[model samples]
Target: MRAQGRAPTTDGAASATDTRNALDLAARPLGGFEAATAGFTLFAAPLSRVLDVELSALEAQGRGQIVSSPRVVTADRVKAIVEQGSELPYQAKVGNGVSGVQFRRATLKLEVEPQITPDGRVVLDLDVTKDSIGEPTAAGPAIHTKHVQTRVEVENGGTVAIGGIYEQLNRDDVTRVPLLGKIPVLGALFRHRARRDQRSELVVFITPTVVGTQCETSGAGDAEAGKRGPEAGGAGSTRQPLCQ
Candidate 1:
């Protein structure tokens, strides 16, 4: 009987492109990878007669619009917008009045890491920070902060959302007379007390896609992809040559 030849095994049959991608990933440093982050603050307040007027004005200009005076502007942006005199405000604040209305702001931040695995899976490491600041009151600013770190494995082209919710108690006092407002027993007669319990949530969304070469092939592709023409295989084709 003639000796039989062995059939090809799928174990070591990875394509050159796949091998190159694996090597590239292994050679890359953590700093070489980059991610995109987006953040915003949401303000929530109890609807009062004074608040209604302010909200109405903001709506007329634009929803979520900010009205700030030049003198009261943030120190950081004072130099940049010195001439504008008035600009939209991102930070919430109370107007100089007796309503005692307060606006609370929610904050969010996120960082993501996508590490490629030889088996075509991605390891996702995430760092998240969130804070909800309550309006200043008789005591002080009410602040709640949360920090989280987590890791998960996902297939290529996947998305994840990480976040948390927090609640804070705020208090304000309205009195027509400044000196009389400080009195203990008699102050109650001259001042109106307002207390609010507010809740806020922070969330961050992240999506990752794998690239086979130093040049990106997704979306509009990299700068070289346009110049490389169809020979670059446009994207996802093995025949295209990768950047050195």
Candidate 2:
């Protein structure tokens, strides 16, 4: 009697399969898991000051206004927030009886998070919001807002800018004799018409600088040295700027 046996597995085939998988993984790019401590400077200004000009040049010239400068010390991918403005109150009425007062924020808020790449570049995730209260009506004050969300990559100490919000003004003037200006058709010869138009835009600029790593061994050593005092070659000692 002959016994039946299962087909034998080939070691060479198994080895080839393992090799292919290892190669695939080796060729794949790894995700960035490193976060960095960073400092951010934000600016809000008129478009005329920033238009058609390099942001770096504008910053070097100190032509743009600085609105917020926030430093993020936590490297846990948490965002840094900057908010400035007022709260507006409005009456809440129920069937002609005042029930309560509600408040709304009219503010300029910014949220930013910085991540470091393998090549030493900085990646910035930003959200910008600007709100303004307009003329009040019978019910409540009108709210005008402009909002933007964006992601940008820049070298350390580099500047990036964004702008689109605009405002336009128009004015008309009739210069004529007092009585002649009041007349409809008969005053045409005596009246002169003049008009003026003006326009402006709001712009935002951002600059991100990677400071030191939160969990870096060198940084921890520096901190320890800083606490050791000058007699131990610690106090009054300076480290080179990490972001330039």
| lDDT (Cα, tens digit) per residue for candidate 1, span 126-158 | 565555464565644665567756654444444
Write down the lDDT of every candidate, Cα atoms only. 0.40, 0.54
Error of 1 at 33 (Å): 23
Off by over 4 Å in 2: 1-76, 94-99, 171-196, 213-244
What is the per-residue lDDT of model 2 for residues 1-244, given as tens digits with 9 covering 90 to 100?
Answer: 0101111111111122223211211111225533222222222223223422543444455443344444434342567777778999876675667567788899877777777776765666767787888879766797788777766565555555545545565889878988976788888988999997755445555555556453433776667666776865645667543432
By TM-score, who's the top model here? 2
Candidate 1 residue runs with Cα over 4 Å from true position: 1-109, 117-121, 131-145, 165-167, 175-190, 211-244
Error of 2 at 22 (Å): 44
- Model 2 clash pairs? none
Question: Model 2 Cα displacement at 184 (Å)?
Answer: 8.7
